[model samples]
Target: GAGVSQSPSNKVTEKGKDVELRCDPISGHTALYWYRQSLGQGLEFLIYFQGNSAPDKSGLPSDRFSAERTGGSVSTLTIQRTQQEDSAVYLCASSTRTITGAVEAFFGQGTRLTVV
Candidate 1:
Protein backbone atom coordinates (compact mmCIF):
# COMPACT_ATOMS: atom_id res chain seq x y z
CA GLY A 1 0.00 0.00 0.00
CA ALA A 2 1.13 3.59 -0.64
CA GLY A 3 0.14 4.46 2.90
CA VAL A 4 -1.30 2.84 5.98
CA SER A 5 -4.71 1.22 5.45
CA GLN A 6 -7.27 0.32 8.04
CA SER A 7 -10.34 -1.82 7.46
CA PRO A 8 -14.00 -1.40 8.42
CA SER A 9 -13.74 2.34 8.97
CA ASN A 10 -16.83 2.26 11.12
CA LYS A 11 -18.09 -0.43 13.45
CA VAL A 12 -20.93 -0.72 15.91
CA THR A 13 -20.84 -3.54 18.41
CA GLU A 14 -22.84 -4.49 21.44
CA LYS A 15 -21.35 -4.37 24.88
CA GLY A 16 -19.50 -7.55 25.80
CA LYS A 17 -18.83 -8.39 22.17
CA ASP A 18 -15.35 -8.58 20.72
CA VAL A 19 -14.00 -6.59 17.79
CA GLU A 20 -10.97 -6.92 15.57
CA LEU A 21 -9.33 -4.04 13.75
CA ARG A 22 -6.89 -4.54 10.92
CA CYS A 23 -4.09 -2.38 9.55
CA ASP A 24 -1.75 -2.63 6.57
CA PRO A 25 1.31 -0.48 6.78
CA ILE A 26 3.31 0.88 3.90
CA SER A 27 5.63 -1.52 2.16
CA GLY A 28 9.08 -1.95 3.74
CA HIS A 29 8.21 0.10 6.80
CA THR A 30 9.69 -1.47 9.90
CA ALA A 31 7.94 0.44 12.67
CA LEU A 32 4.22 0.14 13.36
CA TYR A 33 2.08 1.73 16.04
CA TRP A 34 -1.47 1.48 17.34
CA TYR A 35 -3.29 4.32 19.00
CA ARG A 36 -6.75 5.14 20.30
CA GLN A 37 -8.63 8.41 20.37
CA SER A 38 -11.82 9.08 22.22
CA LEU A 39 -14.19 11.88 21.42
CA GLY A 40 -12.51 15.18 22.27
CA GLN A 41 -9.54 13.31 23.68
CA GLY A 42 -5.89 13.12 22.69
CA LEU A 43 -4.31 10.20 20.92
CA GLU A 44 -3.48 7.38 23.31
CA PHE A 45 -0.63 5.09 22.37
CA LEU A 46 -1.76 1.48 22.63
CA ILE A 47 1.12 -0.50 21.17
CA TYR A 48 4.29 -0.28 19.15
CA PHE A 49 5.73 -2.93 16.85
CA GLN A 50 9.28 -2.80 15.63
CA GLY A 51 9.53 -5.27 12.78
CA ASN A 52 7.92 -8.61 13.73
CA SER A 53 8.43 -8.03 17.45
CA ALA A 54 6.67 -5.66 19.76
CA PRO A 55 8.92 -3.89 22.23
CA ASP A 56 6.17 -1.88 23.89
CA LYS A 57 2.90 -3.42 25.00
CA SER A 58 2.55 -1.54 28.24
CA GLY A 59 0.32 1.04 26.62
CA LEU A 60 -2.50 -1.43 26.23
CA PRO A 61 -5.36 -0.45 28.51
CA SER A 62 -5.96 -3.94 29.86
CA ASP A 63 -5.54 -7.64 29.30
CA ARG A 64 -8.58 -7.59 27.07
CA PHE A 65 -6.67 -5.53 24.54
CA SER A 66 -4.03 -7.10 22.38
CA ALA A 67 -2.23 -6.60 19.06
CA GLU A 68 0.14 -8.40 16.75
CA ARG A 69 2.15 -7.76 13.62
CA THR A 70 3.19 -10.37 11.08
CA GLY A 71 6.08 -10.20 8.62
CA GLY A 72 6.54 -6.58 9.69
CA SER A 73 3.64 -5.46 7.55
CA VAL A 74 0.12 -6.21 8.66
CA SER A 75 -1.14 -5.62 12.18
CA THR A 76 -4.30 -6.41 14.08
CA LEU A 77 -5.84 -5.02 17.24
CA THR A 78 -8.32 -7.11 19.18
CA ILE A 79 -10.55 -6.04 22.02
CA GLN A 80 -12.38 -8.60 24.09
CA ARG A 81 -15.62 -8.22 25.99
CA THR A 82 -15.94 -4.68 24.74
CA GLN A 83 -17.52 -2.05 26.93
CA GLN A 84 -19.03 1.33 26.14
CA GLU A 85 -15.87 2.97 27.38
CA ASP A 86 -13.97 1.08 24.73
CA SER A 87 -15.66 3.01 21.99
CA ALA A 88 -13.13 5.13 20.15
CA VAL A 89 -11.16 5.57 16.94
CA TYR A 90 -8.29 3.18 16.49
CA LEU A 91 -5.36 4.40 14.43
CA CYS A 92 -2.33 2.69 12.86
CA ALA A 93 0.90 4.19 11.70
CA SER A 94 4.16 3.16 10.10
CA SER A 95 7.53 4.82 10.44
CA THR A 96 10.48 4.66 8.12
CA ARG A 97 13.98 6.02 8.23
CA THR A 98 15.04 8.82 5.94
CA ILE A 99 18.44 9.57 4.56
CA THR A 100 19.08 11.94 7.43
CA GLY A 101 18.39 9.14 9.94
CA ALA A 102 15.10 10.69 10.93
CA VAL A 103 12.04 8.47 11.18
CA GLU A 104 8.71 9.68 9.95
CA ALA A 105 5.43 7.89 10.46
CA PHE A 106 2.43 7.73 8.19
CA PHE A 107 -0.95 7.24 9.80
CA GLY A 108 -4.13 5.55 8.69
CA GLN A 109 -7.51 7.22 8.67
CA GLY A 110 -8.49 5.18 11.71
CA THR A 111 -11.34 2.80 12.58
CA ARG A 112 -14.20 4.10 14.61
CA LEU A 113 -15.75 1.58 17.00
CA THR A 114 -18.93 2.29 18.83
CA VAL A 115 -20.07 0.00 21.60
CA VAL A 116 -23.77 0.14 22.13
Candidate 2:
Protein backbone atom coordinates (compact mmCIF):
# COMPACT_ATOMS: atom_id res chain seq x y z
CA GLY A 1 0.00 0.00 0.00
CA ALA A 2 1.46 3.29 -1.13
CA GLY A 3 0.61 6.75 0.09
CA VAL A 4 0.44 9.85 -2.02
CA SER A 5 3.69 10.89 -3.76
CA GLN A 6 4.65 14.22 -5.30
CA SER A 7 7.69 15.07 -7.42
CA PRO A 8 10.23 17.90 -7.22
CA SER A 9 10.03 18.32 -3.50
CA ASN A 10 11.29 21.82 -4.23
CA LYS A 11 10.92 23.78 -7.44
CA VAL A 12 12.39 27.16 -8.40
CA THR A 13 10.83 28.72 -11.46
CA GLU A 14 10.60 31.99 -13.28
CA LYS A 15 7.65 34.35 -13.00
CA GLY A 16 5.90 33.33 -16.17
CA LYS A 17 6.69 29.69 -16.84
CA ASP A 18 4.35 26.75 -16.81
CA VAL A 19 4.87 24.00 -14.28
CA GLU A 20 3.28 20.62 -13.83
CA LEU A 21 3.28 18.86 -10.50
CA ARG A 22 2.49 15.16 -10.33
CA CYS A 23 0.66 13.19 -7.69
CA ASP A 24 0.12 9.45 -7.18
CA PRO A 25 -2.57 8.64 -4.69
CA ILE A 26 -2.86 5.55 -2.58
CA SER A 27 -4.20 2.49 -4.29
CA GLY A 28 -7.95 1.86 -4.27
CA HIS A 29 -8.70 5.38 -3.06
CA THR A 30 -11.52 6.88 -5.08
CA ALA A 31 -11.26 10.51 -3.96
CA LEU A 32 -8.45 12.91 -4.77
CA TYR A 33 -7.96 16.54 -3.83
CA TRP A 34 -5.47 19.31 -4.50
CA TYR A 35 -4.78 22.15 -2.12
CA ARG A 36 -2.46 25.11 -1.85
CA GLN A 37 -1.04 26.35 1.41
CA SER A 38 1.01 29.48 1.35
CA LEU A 39 3.46 30.49 4.03
CA GLY A 40 1.62 30.94 7.31
CA GLN A 41 -1.68 30.41 5.53
CA GLY A 42 -4.37 27.80 5.73
CA LEU A 43 -4.93 25.17 3.09
CA GLU A 44 -6.97 26.24 0.09
CA PHE A 45 -8.77 23.58 -1.87
CA LEU A 46 -8.00 23.83 -5.56
CA ILE A 47 -9.87 20.97 -7.12
CA TYR A 48 -11.58 17.74 -6.28
CA PHE A 49 -12.11 14.56 -8.25
CA GLN A 50 -14.49 11.86 -7.23
CA GLY A 51 -13.85 9.14 -9.77
CA ASN A 52 -13.42 10.58 -13.29
CA SER A 53 -15.44 13.74 -12.81
CA ALA A 54 -14.29 16.90 -11.08
CA PRO A 55 -17.32 18.38 -9.39
CA ASP A 56 -15.51 21.36 -7.96
CA LYS A 57 -12.87 23.61 -9.42
CA SER A 58 -13.84 26.75 -7.56
CA GLY A 59 -10.61 27.06 -5.66
CA LEU A 60 -8.47 27.57 -8.69
CA PRO A 61 -7.06 31.07 -8.32
CA SER A 62 -7.12 32.03 -11.95
CA ASP A 63 -7.11 30.77 -15.50
CA ARG A 64 -3.50 29.74 -15.00
CA PHE A 65 -4.36 26.98 -12.56
CA SER A 66 -5.89 23.67 -13.53
CA ALA A 67 -5.86 20.02 -12.48
CA GLU A 68 -7.07 16.66 -13.72
CA ARG A 69 -7.29 13.15 -12.36
CA THR A 70 -7.21 10.11 -14.59
CA GLY A 71 -8.57 6.64 -13.89
CA GLY A 72 -9.44 7.99 -10.44
CA SER A 73 -5.89 7.51 -9.24
CA VAL A 74 -3.13 9.79 -10.42
CA SER A 75 -3.59 13.54 -10.60
CA THR A 76 -1.58 16.49 -11.85
CA LEU A 77 -1.79 20.17 -11.04
CA THR A 78 -0.67 22.40 -13.82
CA ILE A 79 0.06 26.06 -13.28
CA GLN A 80 0.32 28.11 -16.39
CA ARG A 81 2.20 31.42 -16.24
CA THR A 82 3.49 31.03 -12.75
CA GLN A 83 3.47 34.05 -10.50
CA GLN A 84 5.31 35.07 -7.38
CA GLU A 85 2.08 35.08 -5.44
CA ASP A 86 1.53 31.49 -6.48
CA SER A 87 4.51 30.30 -4.48
CA ALA A 88 3.27 27.81 -1.98
CA VAL A 89 3.18 24.17 -1.03
CA TYR A 90 0.99 22.16 -3.37
CA LEU A 91 -0.47 19.25 -1.45
CA CYS A 92 -2.24 16.18 -2.70
CA ALA A 93 -4.47 13.92 -0.68
CA SER A 94 -6.69 10.91 -1.20
CA SER A 95 -9.29 9.07 0.74
CA THR A 96 -11.84 6.32 0.35
CA ARG A 97 -15.32 7.51 -0.48
CA THR A 98 -17.36 6.21 2.39
CA ILE A 99 -20.88 6.89 3.49
CA THR A 100 -19.63 7.17 7.02
CA GLY A 101 -17.87 10.28 8.29
CA ALA A 102 -14.59 8.49 8.92
CA VAL A 103 -12.99 9.33 5.62
CA GLU A 104 -9.81 11.35 5.95
CA ALA A 105 -7.27 12.61 3.51
CA PHE A 106 -3.72 11.27 3.55
CA PHE A 107 -1.51 14.09 2.33
CA GLY A 108 1.74 13.98 0.45
CA GLN A 109 4.83 15.84 1.66
CA GLY A 110 3.90 18.41 -0.94
CA THR A 111 5.75 20.08 -3.79
CA ARG A 112 7.14 23.39 -2.67
CA LEU A 113 7.01 25.74 -5.63
CA THR A 114 9.00 28.94 -5.49
CA VAL A 115 8.37 31.55 -8.10
CA VAL A 116 11.11 34.04 -8.73
Candidate 3:
Protein backbone atom coordinates (compact mmCIF):
# COMPACT_ATOMS: atom_id res chain seq x y z
CA GLY A 1 0.00 0.00 0.00
CA ALA A 2 1.06 3.60 -0.54
CA GLY A 3 0.42 4.45 3.08
CA VAL A 4 -0.72 2.78 6.25
CA SER A 5 -3.91 0.77 5.83
CA GLN A 6 -6.25 -0.32 8.60
CA SER A 7 -9.08 -2.83 8.33
CA PRO A 8 -12.81 -2.78 9.15
CA SER A 9 -13.22 0.98 9.24
CA ASN A 10 -15.74 0.55 12.01
CA LYS A 11 -16.60 -2.22 14.44
CA VAL A 12 -19.24 -2.72 17.09
CA THR A 13 -18.64 -5.33 19.75
CA GLU A 14 -20.12 -6.40 23.04
CA LYS A 15 -18.56 -5.22 26.26
CA GLY A 16 -16.87 -8.52 26.96
CA LYS A 17 -15.91 -9.43 23.43
CA ASP A 18 -12.44 -9.43 21.95
CA VAL A 19 -11.50 -7.44 18.86
CA GLU A 20 -8.58 -7.55 16.52
CA LEU A 21 -7.51 -4.62 14.35
CA ARG A 22 -5.17 -4.93 11.45
CA CYS A 23 -2.65 -2.59 9.91
CA ASP A 24 -0.54 -2.75 6.80
CA PRO A 25 2.28 -0.27 6.67
CA ILE A 26 3.99 1.24 3.71
CA SER A 27 6.43 -1.04 2.04
CA GLY A 28 10.04 -0.74 3.24
CA HIS A 29 9.08 1.34 6.24
CA THR A 30 11.01 0.38 9.33
CA ALA A 31 8.82 1.85 12.04
CA LEU A 32 5.18 0.99 12.81
CA TYR A 33 3.02 2.40 15.59
CA TRP A 34 -0.43 1.94 17.05
CA TYR A 35 -2.38 4.68 18.78
CA ARG A 36 -5.81 5.19 20.27
CA GLN A 37 -8.02 8.27 20.33
CA SER A 38 -11.13 8.78 22.36
CA LEU A 39 -13.95 11.15 21.51
CA GLY A 40 -12.27 14.29 22.80
CA GLN A 41 -8.88 12.98 23.80
CA GLY A 42 -5.58 13.16 22.06
CA LEU A 43 -3.84 10.30 20.35
CA GLU A 44 -2.32 7.92 22.86
CA PHE A 45 0.58 5.78 21.77
CA LEU A 46 -0.19 2.09 22.14
CA ILE A 47 2.71 0.14 20.71
CA TYR A 48 5.67 0.54 18.43
CA PHE A 49 7.48 -1.84 16.12
CA GLN A 50 10.97 -1.22 14.83
CA GLY A 51 12.37 -3.67 12.35
CA ASN A 52 12.18 -7.39 13.23
CA SER A 53 13.42 -7.30 16.81
CA ALA A 54 11.18 -7.20 19.86
CA PRO A 55 8.44 -4.61 19.67
CA ASP A 56 8.13 -1.76 22.14
CA LYS A 57 4.95 -2.61 23.97
CA SER A 58 5.40 -0.01 26.66
CA GLY A 59 2.45 2.14 25.66
CA LEU A 60 -0.20 -0.55 25.99
CA PRO A 61 -2.72 0.54 28.60
CA SER A 62 -3.17 -2.88 30.22
CA ASP A 63 -2.55 -6.59 29.85
CA ARG A 64 -5.71 -6.83 27.74
CA PHE A 65 -4.20 -4.69 25.05
CA SER A 66 -1.51 -6.25 22.88
CA ALA A 67 -0.03 -5.91 19.41
CA GLU A 68 2.39 -7.73 17.15
CA ARG A 69 4.18 -6.99 13.93
CA THR A 70 5.06 -9.72 11.47
CA GLY A 71 7.82 -9.73 8.85
CA GLY A 72 8.27 -6.01 9.44
CA SER A 73 5.28 -5.37 7.16
CA VAL A 74 1.99 -5.84 8.93
CA SER A 75 0.74 -5.40 12.48
CA THR A 76 -2.27 -6.38 14.53
CA LEU A 77 -3.74 -4.99 17.74
CA THR A 78 -5.87 -7.22 19.87
CA ILE A 79 -8.05 -5.97 22.69
CA GLN A 80 -9.37 -8.58 25.07
CA ARG A 81 -12.55 -8.33 27.13
CA THR A 82 -13.41 -5.01 25.64
CA GLN A 83 -14.93 -2.35 27.82
CA GLN A 84 -17.01 0.72 27.05
CA GLU A 85 -13.92 2.79 27.73
CA ASP A 86 -12.26 0.99 24.85
CA SER A 87 -14.55 2.58 22.31
CA ALA A 88 -12.36 4.81 20.21
CA VAL A 89 -10.55 5.20 16.97
CA TYR A 90 -7.41 3.11 16.66
CA LEU A 91 -4.77 4.56 14.39
CA CYS A 92 -1.75 3.01 12.81
CA ALA A 93 1.28 4.81 11.45
CA SER A 94 4.53 3.97 9.79
CA SER A 95 7.68 5.88 9.03
CA THR A 96 10.82 5.30 7.10
CA ARG A 97 12.86 6.07 10.16
CA THR A 98 12.40 6.36 13.90
CA ILE A 99 9.94 9.08 14.99
CA THR A 100 12.59 11.10 16.81
CA GLY A 101 14.22 12.28 13.60
CA ALA A 102 12.93 14.60 10.88
CA VAL A 103 10.83 11.90 9.22
CA GLU A 104 7.07 12.08 9.43
CA ALA A 105 4.80 9.12 10.11
CA PHE A 106 2.11 8.25 7.60
CA PHE A 107 -1.14 7.42 9.31
CA GLY A 108 -4.02 5.12 8.47
CA GLN A 109 -7.66 6.22 8.29
CA GLY A 110 -8.15 4.48 11.63
CA THR A 111 -10.62 1.88 12.86
CA ARG A 112 -13.45 3.02 15.08
CA LEU A 113 -14.36 0.43 17.70
CA THR A 114 -17.50 0.74 19.73
CA VAL A 115 -18.22 -1.42 22.75
CA VAL A 116 -21.78 -1.60 23.84
lDDT of each: 0.93, 0.91, 0.90
Error of 3 at 14 (Å): 0.5
* Tens-place lDDT digits, model 2, residues 5-99: 99879999999999999999999988889999999999999999898789898999999998888887789999999999999999998888888
What residue pairs clash in candidate 3, if any at all? none
lDDT per residue for candidate 3 within 1-42, as digits (tens), equals 777899989999999999999999999998888999999899
Better lDDT candidate (2, 3) = 2
TM-score (all chains, Cα) for each model: 0.94, 0.95, 0.93
Per-residue C-alpha lDDT of model 1 across residues 1-116, encoded as one tens digit per residue: 77899998999999999999999999999889999999999999999998989989989999999999988889999999999999999999999856675387899999999999
lDDT of 1 at 115: 99
Error of 1 at 106 (Å): 0.4
Clash counts per candidate, in order, are 0, 0, 0
- Model 1 off-target regions past 4 Å? 98-102
